[model samples]
Target: MSQPIPNFYAVIPAGGVGSRLWPLSRADAPKFLHDLTGSGHSLLRDTWDRLEPLTGPDRIAVVTGRAHRAAVEEQLPDIADLNVFLESEPRDSAAAIGLAAAILHRREPDVIIGSFAADHVIRGTRVFEFAVRDAVEVAREGYVCTIGIAPSEPAVGFGYIKRGSELIVDGARDASLVERFVEKPDLETAKRYVADRDYLWNAGMFISRADVLLAEIEASNPSLHAGLIALAEAWDDRDLRGPAVDRIWPTLPKIAIDYVVAEPAAERGRLAVVPGHFDWDDVGDFASLAKLNSHGRKNDLAILGENARILSDAASGIVVSHTNRVISLIGVKDIVVVDTPDALLVTTSEHAQRVKGVVDALKLTGRSDVL
Candidate 1:
C-alpha cells in the first residue's frame, strides 16, 4: 500500500446533471450517483475508493449540491460534516472545486489539493498511485500539476493537453511544462495531436497547493476569487455558510477550471502536466460505458446492466437495461437501447452524443418529471 502524502487533500467536484446519460442519469440523481460500471457501488463511491489510498479516508472532500448531500453522505458513511462541502446552487466546476480548495486552505495553509471528477473510471491502481505521487511531489514544488492521460486514440470527445519542455525538479522527472490546453478538437486535429507525441488527453485531474490554486484564480478571475474567499471565511459558521452560498455563489462566474485556472496558469508558465499511462475513461455517454464491457467481437452485443434479463439475437450493439423486463434485440446492429422506468431511449452508437438533445427537448416540452 502506498503511504498517504503529507497534508494532501483530494477534492471531488460531483455536481453536474449528466443529461447526456439521461433517463438513467436524472437531475436529482446524476451519473455520479449511478453504478454505470456495474461495480455494485455508485461512481461517487468508486471515486472515494480511488483517492482513499493517497489521502486516507478523512482527507477527502466531496463538493456537491445541497440536495445531493444526503446521497453523498449515504454513499460515503465515513465522510465528515466538513468534508462534505454542500453548494446551495450549481456554479460550475470552478466554484465547486475552488470552494473546497479555499476551505481546506483555511484549515491547512500548506495543504496540497488534488481535484478529480466524481464520475471517472480508472484501472491499474499501482500506475495511478505512481502518477498521483509524482503529481504531489510536483505540487509541493509550488507548481499546479495536472495528470495528463496518454491518448490511446484520436478521440475528439475529450480535450487535449500540449506538453512542453520537462521540468528539472527532484522526485518529478516525468513532469513536463504544459504549453497550453486545447478544447475538444475536430477529428483531423485530434488525429494530428495523437500522432504528434506531445499532446495528451486533458483528464481534468489537478494537484497543487491550496494557496497556489487560489492565487491563480485571483489573478485570472478576481471576482470568483473574492466570492470563494468570502465563503471560505464563513464555512465553519452554519448561520453564515447558508447565506453566503445563497448570495455569492450565483454571482460567481460559471466557468470550468480549464479556462479560469489551469489554462491561464499554463500560459503564465505556472502549470505542469504529469503524463499518466493508465486505463482511464470519463464515461461521458452510454457508448463510453459500453467500451468497458465490449467483447471485442463485432457480432457480440455489449450489455452494461443486469445480464439475466438480457438476450441478444443477431444484434451487435450496446444494451443498457435498468428495467425489470427482458431486453431482447433481434437483427439490430450498432444500436443503443437504454431502458428505464420513466423513459426508454433507442438510438445508435453514432448518435449517442445526441442524447443531450433529448433532455433539452424534454425540458422545452415541459417534461420535468422525467428529466
Candidate 2:
C-alpha cells in the first residue's frame, strides 16, 4: 500500500564559516549568500525556493549564526521572524540540528523535519521533491530517512552509505535499509566503494520526526540530548534560550549528524536510504563551485581583464566589476579573478581549495583587513 505523505518541516543549517571560497565568501557573507554562478539568487535562496513547495514558508526554519542572521533574513524575507533561529555562537552541524529540533519539538512533536545545508545545487527539482515525499513517508513509519545520492565517482569529499535489504513501497522509489555509514574514505577505499554499487554518497539530507530524533539523541549522546530537552522545556521563557545556549554550546562535543546519529542507527539497523534521482552538489569548496558552473570551465573564474582572452570554454571562470574598466586576460585558465573595491584573488584552479589556507595564514599574520 502507498504510504500517506507526512507533514514536512525544513531546517536549513547556514552557520558555517565558508573559508574555502574566501575573499568572495567572507565572514559576513558566507558561500551560500554569494552569487557563485553570477546568478542573481544565492544558493541559500535557491534552497529555500526548492523547499517552499514541499514545506510551506511557515514550516520552514533557518538556523544560522548571529553574524549571518541579517544576510539570511535578507535572502529569505518571506520566512517569518520567529521561524529564523539564530545561534548565539558558532556550533557545528550537530549542535545546529539539536537547536532546531528543540525549537520544532516545542511547536509540533510529530512534524517530520528535513534537515539540509544552505549551500547545495540540486539539478532535478521534480525528482528531488518526489524523493523527499517518499522519504517523508518513510520517516512517518518511525525510521530516520536520509536521501542518498548514487555514487557517480570515487569521491573522497563525501561520506558513504552502505545499503542493506530493500524496503520497497508503492509509488515510492526503492529504498534500502542502511547497513553502515562510512566517513570520508581514502582514495583506495573510495574507489572500492564506487566499484561496489551498494554504497551511496551521504548527501547530509535527513528526514525524521522530532520525537524520533530526540529519542535517538537521548540514546546516542545523553548529555547533548539532555541539553536539547532542557532548552525545549524553557523555550517559552524568551530569556532562557540566550543563556542556555551560551552555557551548553561550548561544552557540546563537535560532531556531524552522520557520526552521531546515522552511523549508530545504521549499526542498530534503524537507518534507511531513499534514492536521490536529482543531480546534487554540496559545493563544499571553490572546486565544487567550478564543477557546478558552466561547461568546459571546471574552475571558478571571475574575469575582469580588458581583452581577457579565455581560450577555455568552461564556466569555472567568473568576472565581476561594477566599473566600466575593461580588463583583459590572455591565455589564462582555471583561475578566480575578482576585481573587488578593496581585495583581489588571482590563483590557479588547483590551488582554489587552498584558499582557506591563505585565509588562515592571513589571520596568523594579523592581516584582518583581507579576512
Which structure among the candidates has the greatest TM-score? Answer: 1
Best by lDDT: 1
The positional error of residue 6 in candidate 2, measured at the CA in angstroms, is: 3.6
Name model 1 segments beyond 4 Å from true: none
After superposition, the stretches of candidate 2 with alpha carbons farther than 4 Å from their true spots are: 1-5, 169-171, 185-192, 296-325
lDDT tens readout by residue for model 2, 1-371: 22334478899999776887777777776778865555568889998988888877787899888888788889999989878887777768877887788778888877888898898878788888888988887888778899999777788889888899998755557777998878899999999998998888889998988888878878899988887777767666788877876776677767778767787778887788898877887877655666566444444455432334444454445554433545555566665565555667777656777888989998999997867
Please, what is the TM-score per model?
A: 0.97, 0.88
Write one digit per residue (lDDT tens) for candidate 1, span 1-371.
57898989999999987888888789889999988777789989998998999998999999999899999999999998889898878889988889988999999999999998999888878888889999999999989999999888899899899999998778875999999889899999999999998999999999999999999999989999999999999988978988888888889999988888898889989999898999888988877767666735666677777643987888877887877888878989988888888889998878889999999999999998998
Evaluate model 1: give its lDDT. 0.89
TM-score of candidate 1 on Cα atoms, chains taken together? 0.97
The residue pairs that clash in candidate 1, if any, are none
Error of 2 at 47 (Å): 0.6
User: Where is model 1 poorest over a 10-residue stretch in terms of lDDT?
Assistant: 291-300
Error of 1 at 78 (Å): 1.3
Clashes of 1: 0
